[model samples]
Target: MYKDDGFDLVFSYTFPKCDLDGSYQAVQENSTHKICVDKEGSVLTAVDKIENKTLADAMDCNCLRANLIITSVEKPTCEVNGNYSPIQCRRGTCRCVDNNGNQVCKSSVCEVAEIDRDTLKC
Candidate 1:
């Protein structure tokens, strides 16, 4: 099953898209949605509701189109308005960010372990 999670298409695994531990993920054709494909890479789980009349050989959907598909990397936080959060965190540091997650506000790199998070205010 899949749903348009605003940002991307999310899925529940069974036997085709994935097995016990994982699911099949691929780059979107136009690189828009962030969803998963079949383990055989034949089927794609759409972000929005789709009608599956019968078992299809191949069909594509664009609900999870995201720029980044590398699941390992951490993404910058964003507001509900789709702008970057004022504060963003890296492995060792946190800093002020602009709408696009660009570092901003002169210098505001606070250590991740810093107690006073106010230092991260932009």
Candidate 2:
């Protein structure tokens, strides 16, 4: 159906079945044209329908962004004042290190700490 409308391609991906109610009803009957909804039931801006590229592009971009977010966030063990806990580095700015064979979150700048230690004077 999409190909006849000049769409480059349509995805056959199936989203985990969500309860259909309220605003979620705005989602179309077609799975390929599914809307990106947040946990709060609001549509995500990155996947919202737009001109030119429109539905397929928005859905593809949303899928890519979702995959990137899922893969980029790493759960590293963090230690604060000798107490250890798992922490997710979703922002990509935080750094965790294994100190004494135990992973610990650095109290200072993560990026600077990632630099090779031998090159630094201190």
Candidate 3:
């Protein structure tokens, strides 16, 4: 996604525009969406209502059009797995690390989380 002057030039993951309710294909000659993530990731609460479609056999096999809003990471206060852990984003993007430098999430950079008010953006 390219952001210039506050407007984000997202490949095909913006919202409303790229969101296609169920499944559809881009025209390519005119379609502005592209392949983003293929993993079974969850959309943030803020953008759960948005819809998207997928175009098969495009540039990449994992390309899908969806409006993905990044959310902030929540802190877990209870013991999960072994110690008190921070809740990680189920989208498989960001994970919560312990306060003591423990990698709580199984993903890579996707585990790094940031808190923006009540939302978690990874």
Best by TM-score: 1
Winner of 1 and 2 under lDDT = 1
- Arranged by TM-score with the best first, the candidates are 1, 2, 3
Over 53-108, each residue of candidate 3 has an lDDT whose tens digit, in order, gives: 22222232211222122233533332211122344333433455454324555654
lDDT of each: 0.43, 0.35, 0.32
Descending-lDDT candidate ranking: 1, 2, 3
Error of 3 at 31 (Å): 68
Clashes of each: 7, 0, 14
* Preferred candidate (TM-score higher): 2 or 3: 2
Candidate 3 residues lying further than 4 Å off, grouped into runs, are 1-73, 80-82, 90-92, 99-122
Q: What's the lDDT for residue 8 in model 1?
A: 60
**How well is each residue in 29-82 modelled by candidate 1, as lDDT tens digits?**
322333344444553443321333221213222222231342756766543222
Q: What does the lDDT come to for candidate 1? A: 0.43
Better candidate number, 2 or 3, judged by lDDT: 2
lDDT tens readout by residue for model 2, 23-82: 332223243234444434455432323332344342322232233235445433322211
The list of candidate 2 runs beyond 4 A from truth reads: 1-35, 46-50, 53-122
